[model samples]
Every structure is written in structure tokens, then in C-alpha cells.
Target: MSEPFPTIRRPADRTQMILLFIVLTAGLAAGLAIYSSATSFITFIRTASSALFLPILLSLVLTFLLEPVVSFFERTTGKRTGSIFIVYILCAMLLYLLMQFIIPQWQSAWNSLQADLPRYIKGMTNYIRDLGLKIEAQTPFIDSADLVERGRSLGKDIVNTVIVGTPQSALRLGGLFLMVPLFTFFFLRDGSRILRSCISLAPNRTFEMVHDLSYLITKQLSHFIRGRIIEATIIGIVIFIGLSFTDIRYTGFLAVFAGVTNLIPYIGPLIGMIPGILVALVDLGIGGQFWWIVIVYFLIAQVIIDNFILIPILISRYSNLHPLWVIIAIILGGNAYGILGMVIGVPIVSTLKIIFIEIRQYRRTFSLSERLPESES
Candidate 1:
């Protein structure tokens, strides 16, 4: 008799089918929600956009950055509470010094510009007339008066707009300023607990992979943020000194703007130069000397910072990305969300690049396995 037929059960496809159903349902729900949101959104996006989020984002980034420091403190003190308390105290003191000392000096410089406006305006007018005379002497046919009048009209338009809009903008800004510190304090206090709670919910099968990615993201983000602050601070101080040496009247204000803009990566240097050049033009008028000297200073400073400072740090940390990719990311980000996007685009791109690399590696290994010859049976 033939061996008794044993029951053979086919592998259940239920698990995969359930997963596919869940994914499809989620996708459909997301699509519907997004469509509804697009159709019925009620908030003014600009008003909704707040710097209140900045401190929270900064605190989250800071928590990661200072995690090692906090951990060291914990190790020495043998208590997490002590570590957090000590770290927070130091951070608070630093912030207080920045607000009390640095900001006041910067504000003083700004006030000086406002006070010396009449002198600056007179110097500018004389310089412009001299330029007009030289141009008329060189090309005795062109309408110099029309050109000068148009320039004055444009300046008046810009000044008028600023004067009209500033108070409203300030009121909006005051609201966010009130909110940022509160958000930051909570983020700093609870960030680790929040992270751990989020991590705990990840599926067991994917936990290790997720944890590794989390660590990588933490490192990359912290490095990028900390490096940016340091670089911007250094650039701002250098610009202040360089501009003060020159005859540009708004040196301090321009330098501070440049430093703040420098946080935006590749596009930052170009953006930072605009205020400097404009102030230089306004101060010395439209003369070749003013333009040439301002351009030269900007070029020299950018060269020094780009080659000597950002190169070594960025090249090693973001060796995976190309300059072309960086530029594309900046442009896309700027178009999508303006300055904030430009500032954050490169770091976001770097994170995505890491994820893409891992995915590609996994796919390649899987493909190789499928292509290999089977053993003889």
C-alpha cells in the first residue's frame, strides 16, 4: 500500500492580504483628507506660520545636540534629573547673556543709523549729483534728470511700503515672540520622554532598523544645526569688522543681517550680500568706487568662509551629496516656502539621501539573491 497521504497545508496569504488592505485604506483616507483640507482650509497661512515653532524646533535639535553632555552629567551624578537641571541652567544662562549683551549692542548700532539718517541722506544726494555730472560729461546725449528722478521715486516707494507695513508686521511678530520661549521650555523638558514614547510604538520587526535610522538622523541634524550656528556667528563677527573698516555707514546692521542669512547654506552668501550692497549704494550713491569696494569685500569674505570654513566641515559630513543636488534642493525649497525652506532644504535632502541609499542596497542584495543559480536537487 502507498504511504498514507499526509495532510499538506498551503501557506496562508492572509497576513500579506491584510497588510495590503490596511495600506490601501490608509492611502485612500489620506487622499480624501488632503482633498477636503485643500477645499475648505480657513486659516490665513501666513498668520498660521509662526516663529513660535522655532524655539520648539531649536530645543528639539538642542536636546539631541546636548544629549551626550547630558548623558555625561548623568553618568557622573547618577541621576537623570540632575543632568537635565544642570544642562538647562547652563543653556538658560547662555541665552540670557545673548539677549542682554549681544542684542543690546546690535540694537545700539541700528539706533545709530536711525539717528544719522539726515547726514546719510545728504551724503547720498551729493554723491548721486556728482555721479550724474560725470555721466553727463561722458555721454552728452542721455537724460540724466529722468534717470535720477526714477531712482528717487523707486527709493520713495520702498521707504513708503516699509513705513506703512512695519507696525502690522511688528504686532504679528510680538505674538510669536511671546509663544517661542514657552514652546522651547516644554520641548527641552520633555523631548527625551516624547522620543522614547514614540519609539516604543514602532513594530517589533522594524524596531532595530528604525532605532538605527533615528540615531543617524539625530547625529546629522545636530551636526548640521550646531555647525550652522557656529559658522553664522563667526561670519557675522567677521562681516561686522570688515564693514566697519570700510566707509559704509550701516555696517553693523548689514553684518548682522548677513550673519543671520548665512544659516541658509549655499544660497545664503548671495542673499546676505544684497543688504550690504544696497546700503553701500545708498551711502556712497551710485558711484563706481562704492560698487567696486563693496563687491570686492563681499567676494573676499565669501571666498575665505567657503574655502576655509564650510568646505572641510560640509564635505566630510555630507560626502554623499553633490553640489548640484544641494543647489537644486535650495532652489526648490525657496520656491516652496521661501527663506525657511532654503535654510532647511539641504539637511532634509541629506536625510532623504541616507534613506535612499539604504533602500537601494537592500534592493540590490535581493535582486542578486533571486538571480543566483539554484543548487542541484
Candidate 2:
């Protein structure tokens, strides 16, 4: 009867099950503790401005973006340091040229925007008053005068903020700008050494796994950053070109705003719309439903193209994340790291996924003590 079909399990099997459960439970507790501590550390590090750590972190991010160019130059020159300098110099020149050509237009648009603010507010208020008149018979709650007063107060506050905030913002940015390139140079020059040092921390059994995990994270991360940058550029250019053909005021500013905000995901596009909406309402003279229609149509069109066409073509190819997970990652990252968190959240999550996958794949390759029966161990 085939030994009674081995109907009863061995005591060894029960011991193995207990060991597995204990191991899993311990691991879960450790993981949660580690995660909490890591986030706290990250938050602390993010607040430091004078620290080399911030620059080093920024360099790592830029390295991922500029690795290809650096590699190409390295191959041609056979000198990593030389390649980095050449790339930096080239970047400086390109930036200078771009600023030379584009800054004037931006300056002009900004001035125009500033000058038009009060007039725009007045136009909007007058239009609202007209509309309120039409609706006042039916709705006694409509108050155009109150809205006008509030609008002017808001405009004045915005103007004051621009006047006071720009200097501080520029000063902070200047410090980061200097630090980023300085650190990026070192990272580009000695990145392999850095990687080697990090990999050295791994156990002998996981040396190969560590190497492969690093490669996987770097590959996916670079792809994601490159894709995001290209996507932003494309979106900006599309908006610029589309608005150029339309009658939108401050096209350059609006395009730039949209592109920059597009980095934040989900909430980004809506924030981008704020500036555009404000500008459109001002230019279109409020009760101009035709221009409102145009704005709505443009927004809908951009949404369709961004979600259906550009996203799949650009970002989805690199990170196969579901929208729900992405939204959650953004929220968690934002809560933990603020803007930087939101920006790096998806890539961070993707890298974590890769690490876990590597861990699982190599789990069996570890010592058999845990995998074997207690008697065998």
C-alpha cells in the first residue's frame, strides 16, 4: 500500500514550518524598523545645505543622467577625468548660449506679465460685474465688488512675493548650482571606486548578487531619469509650439512652468494649469467663453496625448509601474522627502523592487542550513 501513502507528516516537517514562520516574522519586524530609521535619516540629510553629503547625492543623480555622455567621451579620450571636464565645459557653453538667446524673451515675458496683472484684474472684475448683473436678478448672493477687492488684494500679495522671494530663491539655488557640478566631477571620475567600496560591504556569497543588483539599479534608474527628462522636454516643446499658434499670453513662461511641474506626477499637471489658467483668464478677458473653450480643449487634448500617447511611448517603456502604485509612491515619497521625494519616488521604488527581486532569486544560493530540515542542519 506504498507505506500507507505517507498519510502522516514527519515531525521534521513541523519543525521546518515553525522555523520558517519564526524567520519570516522576525524579518518583517526588522524590515519595518529599518525602513522607519532609513526614512528618518533621509529626512535629516535632506535638510542639510552645507554638507558634502547633499552634493554627493546630487552628483549621483546627475551621474545617472550624464553617464552615457561621460562614457562616450571616456572611450574616445581614454581618460575619465578629461571626459568629465570636457563634458562640463561643453555643458557650460551650451547653457550660456541658451541663456543668451532665451533669457531676453523670458525677461520680456515676465515684465509683460507683471505690468498686465493689475489691468487683468480690473478686466476680470469688470467682466465679473457684468456677469453678476446678468445673474443678480436670479441670485442675490453674487457680489462682484467683494470679488474685485479680494482679487486686487491677492494680486498685490503675489507681486510682493515676487519682489521679495526671488532674491532668496536665487541665492539658495546659486549655492546648489556650484556644489552639484563640483561633486559630479568627482563622481564621474571615481564612480567605479565608489561602487566597489559599496559592493565590498556584501557577504562573500552575495558578492555576485550585489554586483548584479547595482548594475540593475543603475540601468533602470538611468533609463528612468533620461526618460523623464526627455518627456519633460517634449511636453514643454509641444506646449510652446501649440501655444505659439494660439493667442495665449506669456507662452514661454507657461510652457516652462508646465514642463517643470510635469516632474511631480498626478498633481504636477494641475499645478501647471494654474499659471496657464490665470494667464488665459487675463488675456481672454474673463467672460470670453470662446477662449475658455479653447483652454478646456487644449487641456483635454494634452491630457489625452500625455496619458495615451507620450506616456506609453516614453515613460511606460522604462518603468512598467501601475498608476495606482505610482500615485502611492508619490504620496509616500512626498510625505517623507518633500519635493525631492516626489521627484525620485518612482525610481526609488523601482530600485527597491529590483533589490527585493535579486534577494529572492539569490535566496536559495545562500547556505542550506535555513533551507534544510533541522535534523540535517
Candidate 3:
């Protein structure tokens, strides 16, 4: 039929293919081993240097947040030292005001909370017993007495845990507060020089790539950290204002708790709501008008303000993460480091994504250039 197409065949390099496969497999196994060892070494180092870690971490965060202000001041004064000094003075004043005004309210709210906690627990227990009886009346299988007993046991355990942990937590926090400013000052002063020194160590071939990667990573982290702090502050203020209208006890403390917990994504807002709702239920009866008002306020704060306005404006653009990946990262982080893991998981994953993307782009460009020469030839 039309002299048929010549059967095109190529010589098979089975022996070469086998050797190539072996080499690739061996390389992959070696790479995995090396990676595992490096990870273990890094983890060991981090654990060994754990005491120095927190202050450094907090300093870096403060540096990121305050860098723009410092930069602006530097531009105006033409002296980096003066810029940092001015910013330091401003920060000191801010801290002084916080200590004078905000701390007192928070302390008062906390003391009130501690004093009323036992009474609140007892009231909740009674409420639960009554509710359980009503439920048991409706459904014979329900055991209200057992439920009340369990609730009481849980409340007691919570109180005991808080009492046991508070002093240690306070001591650690006080030490951190003292160390963070010193570290932050040095970081602000020498951050640029340190970055250049790090980049200079990279090979010539990777020099530009490393520079770009460092800049991109730093910029991304700065935007994220600064945005999160602003977002948390705004949310705290909104919560405090909203709760002020309600009869909630410890509004300042509850708002502060909510703000702190908001660092964890997705479930953070829900976690923040728990204490407020529980207190509302204990103070103002469950299913009452005020209880409903408290729930509605939280909904408006989270769904309307946070989801619609704050997130879109501040976080969403920088994060650019898919919801599924965010959830997975949070889960993995929480599993690895508990609350701290959950807080940092997204940023870590985002940084890795940036590295992956940059490498992929570099390879693609290299491949395209190689093929262009071949095509020209």
C-alpha cells in the first residue's frame, strides 16, 4: 500500500539504561540520607541553643515590623543611629503608655477572672445539671448526672493546670521581654551588612539567585509579620469595643486572649470565642438574649470584619496560599510543635514554596536557552 512507511527503529541501549537507572537510584538514596542527617543535626543545634532562640526570633519579628519606620527616619535624618534612636524613643513611649493604661486594665480583668473563676465554675455546673435533667426528661438514654460530674471534673482540672503553669510562664515571658529589645537594636543596625556577608559566601553561578531569593524571602516575611501584628491589634481593639457594650466580665482579658490566639489560622478565631462564650453562658444564662448578642458580635467580628476587610486587605495578597495547603501546614505544624508550630507553619511552607518556584523558574529559563541554541544551530 503506497510502498508503506519504512519501519523506523532505533538501537536499544538497555545496558546503558540499566546503568543510568542504577546511578539515579543510588544518587536519590544518598541524597535522602544526607538530607535526613542534616535535618537531625539542625534540630539538635536548635534544641541545644533553645534559650537563645526565642529572643532572637522575637527580635527578628520586631525588626521586621519596625524596619520601615527606621528606614523613613534614616532617610530624614541621614544617620542610621539617629533613626534607630528616634524609633526607640517612640517605642519606649508606646510601651510606657501601654504599661500605664492597658496593663492596669488587663491586670484588673485578670484578677477579677481569677477571683470569679470558682464561682463561675460552680454556676456552670449547676446550669449543666439543670440542662441535663431537662434533656434526660426528653430522652431516657441521656445521663445528666454523669454529664454534670464530668463537667465539674474538667473545670477543676483546668483551674489546677492554670494555677500550676502561670508562674513559670510569667517568669519566661519577663526574661523574653528584657532580652528582645537588645537583640532588636543590633538586628536593626546590622541587618543589611549581615545579609550582604551571607550572600557573598554563595558561588558565583548562584550569587544572583541567592541574592534574589534572600530579598524576596525577607520582603515576604516582613509583609506577613507586620500585617499579622496590625491585624491582631485591630481585631483586639474591635473585640474590646464590641464586648464593652455587652455584660461580659473580663472583656479586656478576653480580647487580649483572642488577639494572641488569632496568630493561628482557620481555627484561631473559634478558639478565641470559646472563653468568651463560656463566660457569657455562666454569667448570663445560656440561650438568653445577652448570650445570643455575644455570639452575634463574635460572628460579625470574625465573618464580616476579619474575613472580608482585614484578611483581604492585609493577609490574603501576601499569603497567596490555597486553603487546603494552609490547613495541611497547620495540622503538620501543630503535630510537630503544638501551638508554636501552628503559628509558624504557614510562613514556613510559604518560604519553601518561594524557593521551589525560584529554582523551577531558573531551570525553565536554562532549558529554554539551551534549546534556543540547538534550534539556531
Which number leads on TM-score? 3
Instruction: List, residue by residue over 1-377, the lDDT tens digit for candidate 1.
Output: 89999999977699988999999999999999998887556444444443434445555655656767877888899887678788878978998988897787767765675555445444445566678889999999886775466556655665565556568767856764566545544555576677778887999998876776666655665665666666677778877777766677666677777887776656677888876775677666667757654654466567767557665765345434677888988888778666667776775686677656655655687687877765322
In model 2, the runs with Cα more than 4 Å from the true position are 1-46, 49-58, 115-160, 286-305, 317-377
lDDT of 2 by residue, 316-368 (tens): 44355657877888899789766667766765676576556555645655555
Which of 1 and 3 is ahead in TM-score? 3
Overall local distance difference test of candidate 3: 0.81
lDDT of 3 by residue, 255-357 (tens): 8878877766677777887778778877776666466546544676788878889988887463657778889989998897667678777767866775566
Query: How do all the candidates rank in terms of TM-score, highest first?
Result: 3, 2, 1
| Candidate 3 Cα RMSD (Å) | 11.2
Off by over 4 Å in 3: 1-46, 122-150, 287-297, 318-332, 350-377
lDDT of each candidate versus the true structure: 0.67, 0.72, 0.81
Best-fitting candidate, scored by lDDT:
3
Backbone clash count for every predicted candidate, in the order shown: 0, 0, 0
Range of the 10 consecutive residues with the lowest summed lDDT in candidate 3: 288-297
Assess every candidate by TM-score: 0.64, 0.68, 0.76
